[model samples]
Target chain A: MPEAAGVSADLSIFALFWQAHWVVKIVMTGLLACSVWVWAIAIEKFLLLQRTRTAMNRFEQAFWSGQSLEELYRSLSSRPNHSMAALFVAAMREWKRSFEGSTRSFAGLQMRIEKVMDVTISREVERLERRLLVLATVGSASPFVGLFGTVWGIMNSFQSIAASKNTSLAVVAPGIAEALFATAIGLVAAIPATIFYNKFSSEVNKQASRLEGFADEFSAILSRQIDERA
Target chain B: MRKALTISAVGHAVLILWGLVTFVVKPLEANTTESLPIDVISDSEFTQITAGMKTAKKVETPKPLVEKIGEQKPVEELTKIEKKPAIQTASAEPMPIPEPKKPEPKPEKAKAEPEKQAEPEKAKPAEAPPPDPALEAMKKAEEQKKVEDQKKVEDQKRKAEEQKKKAEEKKKAEEQKRKEEAQRNAFDPGKIAALLDKQSPRREAATGDTINQTASLGLASGRSATLTQSEIDALRAQIQACWNPPAGAVDGRELIVRVRLQLRQDGSLSVDPAVMNRGGHPQFQIAAEAALRAVRRCQPYRLPIAKYDVWKDVEVTFDPRDMFRG
Candidate 1:
């Protein structure tokens, strides 16, 4: 049987945190908060991006399923929450508003519809990218914050040296370990946040381009229809 | 959106719970120490018991036994009581056998209490045949006085021995001073010049002799009969075993000390080692002392007799740069 000494040794991560100085403790707590926020935002954005892609695919299929624009608009139960659906609805609403004022006022109808769609696209992209700045900040700033913690911990280690008048490795190893743990946690918070922020930013860009392509095609179709009526 | 928000909130809650478990709750569990209750008697209770014993002792009168063992027994003499039990049992065994012979002298007493009182009086005499308590006390006082006198003699002898040691140390220091003075007086330039002239031809021949010896031995090419790397390593190992440098001498730049040794043909040091160069710092002094101690402890090195001229007056530099201190 193995000895129970391993469990009794005060060298666990939790023990290091418990033995850390107050400033180091604050640093650790901040890093932990950053890690939590990074994970939460990553998960939320992942779900949101997946839902947006699915909604866009479904809306595009409906738009190209030989169903009339009025039929598809009536089929949607409420104002669409996904970016692509919101963009389509905003453009269609502008089209309907222009028609309500004048049926054949084709001078600025396409421009007005394009302007509304552009505004809605920007709004939807902003909604899609909510909480991503937190990820970027955590990725860029956590390491320096952890470095500050390590410097503080090492300073404390030197203070212990002066107070005890001994420079043995046993006297200072735990302090250094606690300090390095801060840096390790910072890296842990940073790496995934950085990876996911880049990934989510690219996904938003792809969605925006797809929405813009759809908007231009829809405006072109409207322009041809106005020409036909005139 | 609602589902995603709920999922994010749940993820945050789980992460927070994990952090709390590892940092707070688990640490608390690990830190929990089992406290045992110790029974401590109060000071008042101890004082009361001591007071009761003092009163009880004052009320009781002393017994009138023929041999009171307690007062007559010295602390050291009590150690003998452990050995006396076997002798007591051996003597008691013979007392029962002698009971029949004693019945003739005390016929009326033996008949009145044949088993108990007659045998006990005879057995008591057999067990302890010592004098009265007052007489024993006088003898014990004399023995204690003898022991005290012996102790005083031993203490005087110890003092004399200490004085002798101090005188011997002083004599050794004076002898060392005399030897240093002799060495200073013996440094003659004329003798050194004559010896160098006498050994010059032999020194040239010794180089050829070393070349021939190495060639014949085939140990290694370019070898000489002088101190080789292996010999130096052996010398270093011997000295290192004895070198106990002072603690916290980590900085090496200021701790180097150079000493010159003059060894005889038989490897015994011919003259006192002279410190050639020292840093003049206190730490350097400590290092020099340590190096000198090492040289002293590992004296009478086994040097090659043929290469005595090479190692006869060698300069050793004590450098502790490679020593790792934590």
Candidate 2:
């Protein structure tokens, strides 16, 4: 019965916002915007990350399945959505360029291939980790923004007291609720942003490391071929 | 890159849509019509006040109605048995279709029976009379009993009516008394306004003795006024510790409650603390109640005992300005 009565009291999010002072209302709006943007980033990042991992696994499996590297490279070159396939293409293109130019020493050619692969890995990692700064900003700043709203709301509440000279709970409850709601929204925006930011960053790091390993192995293969040819 | 942007845009749009839907769909019920700060009192106090009303209702129990019906049943049964014999003797002849000639009060009794059954009296008397009345005395006795039953029912009805009227009168009297008391205690706002107008000029013209008198009365026992500002501050602080106005009261900042209470030399409240100038604004009742409870809860106030002449009758005005400010 009390719970039902409480609901009827209109302590809902919208009502709290409506009842809030102008400053508190602005705070709530900002927090809401943060929440929406953070959630969108989280969703986009999660999907992209999942797709990248799946693609990397598929490319790794095909690369080790005893298929010819050149045939595999040609197939991946047509559509290299994943970082692994892109890295392979980058290294293979460098290898072809080095062979076409016989003026270059074998050691120099190998170094160039390795350098190209490293550059490609960095670019792929950067692309994969896009829009993560928004998450980081939201995570770090939302709570403080919420606190600012609360402080402003409380100031209004005090001013109301000076004007009315009455110390009843009903007068201040709505304002305080409005103030607290900003903080609550802040936490709501911040928590997921923080969690997913950390999760995605680590995933990006792992993917980058995997690509580096693949580049190193490919470089070794080329080095052995160059030694045999010399 | 394009897929991620599209996904982010779609997700962002959905979230904003969800927020807007929530904002428009549900509205706050404006049931906060009682602009009273009721939360000042504990739940138990509310229940106790409600329980008092229940007792008032319980005093007018419906048991009397049922008893009245039970008392009438025996007389009714005797009449029924008496009519049965007469009907048996006449049963031989062909009864008229309209039965207008039959002088029995069947319709009257039928109407009364429905009323009796409406209440569902538990003691349904089933009287089995003999084939005949053996003596004239017995017939007279049954007739007397029927007359007595009629009188008893009429008496019961009059009593019920009287009770209802008395209850209503008592309720009205109480309401009137409360109103009168409220009027008596209410401060005249016009007088306060006039006092404010004259205050500064009067203060400048006032003699030294009158100023001392005002100061003494403002913070003293009726006998001798010897109070210090620090002691008054201490008392105020003690009460302030107990005064937790509901959030609404703080928001309605213009509401300041001045409670006048008598305190013993020991600093305990002697009488029930009352909100001075109550009933001026109906909205202040809850806030007043809260202030009263705060004064009551912070008993044995830490006032300076040496100046008993100064701190006996105290009036505390709770202002919400500092609370909201902090």
Candidate 3:
């Protein structure tokens, strides 16, 4: 005679995946999705910030290379520019508009330039930070989701134990291992999302400040031009 | 967004492929009860954790049986037959000399059970017994046959000292216990075993626990071992399952049958079990034959290999009264 046939324990990954409760399966699937989405957002956001930083470098080089302000503005306003170029164009547009009519509105032209630049800087910062909230949400919430899956799996295993009435390690080991797999996947998804979220948020802040510094310098250059024209 | 999804799919595919190649765990007591230190290596250990056959090797294989016996007894007990020096007289109550060879150095690894669990002390006890009957005689006959034959006893003492300095003391203690036990048991042969079990728990604790039986109860050189009460009960039950009491044999005279058995280490009969008191009555012969058949049918008994010496030669009395759990 031999042991009862009910307790056949297999702990392979695929077996674990298929044998787990539906709740745990769904949790694992969702964690995997979070992983994918986090990586995607990280990639797109990284590329976006890199592009803006380079564009700002090019725009700053053109502005300070002894080129005329009007010429720089003309060239940039004609073509789409991000970050520093966009702020320069918005400010120069208001300056150009004031001088167009016989009664040039030089009375509030600096204020208008500052207002437009402020709007452009905020808009550019908003673009650079797109999809980052998703990263933060996934990072913070995924571990808890994984925990839920583990709880559900453990509960399901206990139920099976009660049903079978066998307390052998063979009876319960596979189930517990499968249940813990949900947590494993969850940790995989959560760790990277958290790391990237912290990294991207800091990069976004640095980019915003660079844009602001450029805007301040550009306004100073415009103020000199306004004094010369007046 | 779609390109990100494609890249994510690729990454996931690599992860899953790695997982399929590597990530796994194993369980204890599924097939070999053989699980420990699992990592990213050896997926096969984790792959086939098939269960339910943990104890399947214990079933008996039947064999052709019986040395016929006739008219049986009222009540009988199991008797151990001490051969050669110990076989002085059948009626002279053969109190066992506690065979000197408590341990043999090696057993050429049994096929089904490859137990290498013999600790270092087993070797220590091997050379202690220069007086062992079978395997030591054979080993001595081989090692010192043509050369240094008379120096065999002196060589054994030297070897025993070399292996373990405590061998002399251990042997002295064992001899003292066996002599004391043998002296005490010259009264009754049947009560000796039960008395040994009862008295030993107290007396042997003061003496030592490593009172090993002859280790080579199997095919090769070995040590001694003993069965616990539960294990003895299991062995008895296994035999009883195969036993069929002769239906019409009634009365106190035909109730009991004592069979003297000589079993090899694997639990099969080394020689036909001799029925000690076979009378010329037909009903008694049926009872005796039935006992012999049960003994023959149960082959390769699941006695512990560690305790091989204790059960190597056991006398079982088949009584229709106790349902053979006795």
Top candidate when judged by TM-score against the true structure = 3
TM-score of each: 0.44, 0.45, 0.48
Candidate 1 fraction of reference contacts recovered: 0.09
Give a tens-digit lDDT track for model 1, residues B196-290. Answer: 64544431122111121111212222122347668777666666777776667677678877766666665656565667685956788888888
- Best-fitting candidate, scored by lDDT: 3
Candidate 2 lDDT tens digits, B247-280: 6555555567888866775677766676775545
| Best-first order by TM-score | 3, 2, 1
Worst 10 residues of 2 chain B by lDDT: B61-70
| Candidate 1: regions farther than 4 A off | A1-9, A102-104, B1-326
**Model 2 lDDT per residue over A63-151, tens place:** 88999988998887888888889889988887777777757566687778888888999999999888898999999999999999889
Q: What interface Cα RMSD is found for model 1?
A: 8.6
Among incorrect, acceptable, medium and high, the docking class of model 1 is incorrect
Tell how far residue A90 is off in model 2, in angstroms. Answer: 1.0
Score residue B235 of candidate 1 by CA lDDT.
63
Q: Mark the 10 consecutive residues where model 1 chain B has the least summed lDDT.
A: B206-215
On DockQ, the candidate that comes out on top is 3
